[model samples]
Target: MNPIRDIVILCNNRMAFPAIQTLHSLGRLHTIGLPAENEDVKAFCSVFAAKAGVNLIVMEKLKLNIHLQEIVRINTLKCVFTMTFPWKIPEEIIEKNPNVFYNFHYGLLPEMRGADPVFESIRKQKHESGISVHAIEKEIDKGKIILKKTLPLRTDFTHGMLCTHLSYLASYILPELFTLLHLNDKGVQQDETLAQYYKKPTITDVSIKWEHQNSKSIQALVNACNPWNKGAYTQWNGINIRVLEVSQIQTATEQAKTPGTVLEINENNGLIIQCYDNTLLRINTVYTDEGFMSGHKLLAFGLKNGEQFASI
Candidate 1:
């Protein structure tokens, strides 16, 4: 009557590391399935499996389900876990018995239900952020929810910080989830009306659209892309630079200048630029050809005061 029998963990990132530990501690872990293509994750999983005395299988991207079939052959009883696993599960794997397959999703399901939820949540300046444990269905993030835990999204939180926070949160919630599974509790269905699948962010999504976005929105994008894309991008002197960080120092009563125009390059206040709503955003850190440097350094790099940023 044990629901955790014959468990297999399919993981591709460090986010799953804590969950793997929890599963093993519960004496429920069986096999760990890793993506062969990701050398970093594979290396971690290999060492983990050896140290923990567990079965490890490295499956190729296209042959993922085939590897799952192999695991299934060994034992028909099914239970599985997915954490930040990149590839989508084929229908065949779930068609047999879907309830036992649970995915640890980093984002709030049915709402922020797509790729890079970490970035999307921060960039949108979402008031709350959380983790969702759901039964994996054929569709992504549409699975019934087993448990959800949320926390206030901090103003200074970056993509990496939020991700690390949720990983620990996932570990904290897994025991409760296993209890529900033990009772044969099928999770509640998500509301279709509230669901929206966000696509993976593109260059355009990360780029700082100075002409359209306000100071707050632009800063949000900068935070969202930090420790990843470096920052929202723009051009100065026809060379690309990433705005890694920014701040709103003041506001203008009028447009004064075009959005993206450098209003002033101050020694103490740094590189202040105008935004769409006439708000003046002070650039604190940026990435240039010279590597990471202060926004004030843009002037030394030959960008003059009152000059407009080249539109991307």
Candidate 2:
């Protein structure tokens, strides 16, 4: 019964919680690595490692290789897993490791790969979204799969909501991963034909182009931005606004005009705004310099019917 712990995890987001907790509980987590640049993430993981009685290493870009050397030297390890780590591991370092390494992604690989898959999944309105656990390879995210599991991606899930949910999904996948590893299963390769990669989004990527977007697309954009970019970016009378919540109206008012026109407002439905293709969307909530408020409350802030939302 050789019993020295044998796994290390390199993580950036707190969304890695369930997987890390599962590893610790299974008595297999040996060391944890977090980037030193992120103060909050570093602080939280520090406390977690302390309480779990495991080793914690602060990974600085220049010192990362040195730390990894120390990790292999001091620990009896099987594999190192990464969750949302912002950079790549040098191939030389990985080649020298005593065991293999894996990457845990928030999206189904081959089709949805690269940065911010959680947001991209919702923004693209996929039928379903989930997690991927794969062996690390020379090309990032193009790894051999240990497991992939998905959940029904609801139309209403915000980026924040879907992200947290996927973390829980990863929790379930972890146990299955342990079993697969015990059998020494060499995971299957990915098909390059089905692959589509998204680059990390810039500030411009999330802006709402009201004039060109239909109701359903606008609403998807809004939900994808909630509790993240605040909401999809737009403008009201030349002032910037962040829409937090919205709904697609089945039938817009018969009388049509230019898109982005404020058609009406009601206590329950909030604000009715015209979109492209004569489609309509209800603005439920938004964030402004005035603070977060329901769409109807914007009335008191000088909102009026017939006013125009700048085509931003």
| Stretches > 4 Å off in candidate 1 | 1-6, 74-78, 250-255
Model 1: lDDT to the true structure = 0.84
Specify the highest-lDDT model's number.
Answer: 2
Q: TM-scores across all candidates?
A: 0.92, 0.95
Candidate 1 lDDT over residue span 1-312, tens digit each:
563546688888888888788888877788888888889988988998999888999989878778877877766445788888888887777887667678888888778899888888898899988998888888889888888889689978888788888888888887787778879888899999988788999988989888899888988999999978888889988889999988876657454688899988867879989888787799999998779999988877788788988658
**Per-residue lDDT tens digits of candidate 2, residues 115-200?**
98888888889989988888887798997888889889999999999988998888778778888987988788899999999998
Clashing pairs in 1: none
Look at candidate 2 and give me any clashing residue pairs. Answer: 110-195
Q: Once model 2 is optimally superposed onto the true structure by TM-score, how far is the C-alpha of residue 249 displaced, in angstroms? A: 1.7
lDDT of each: 0.84, 0.85
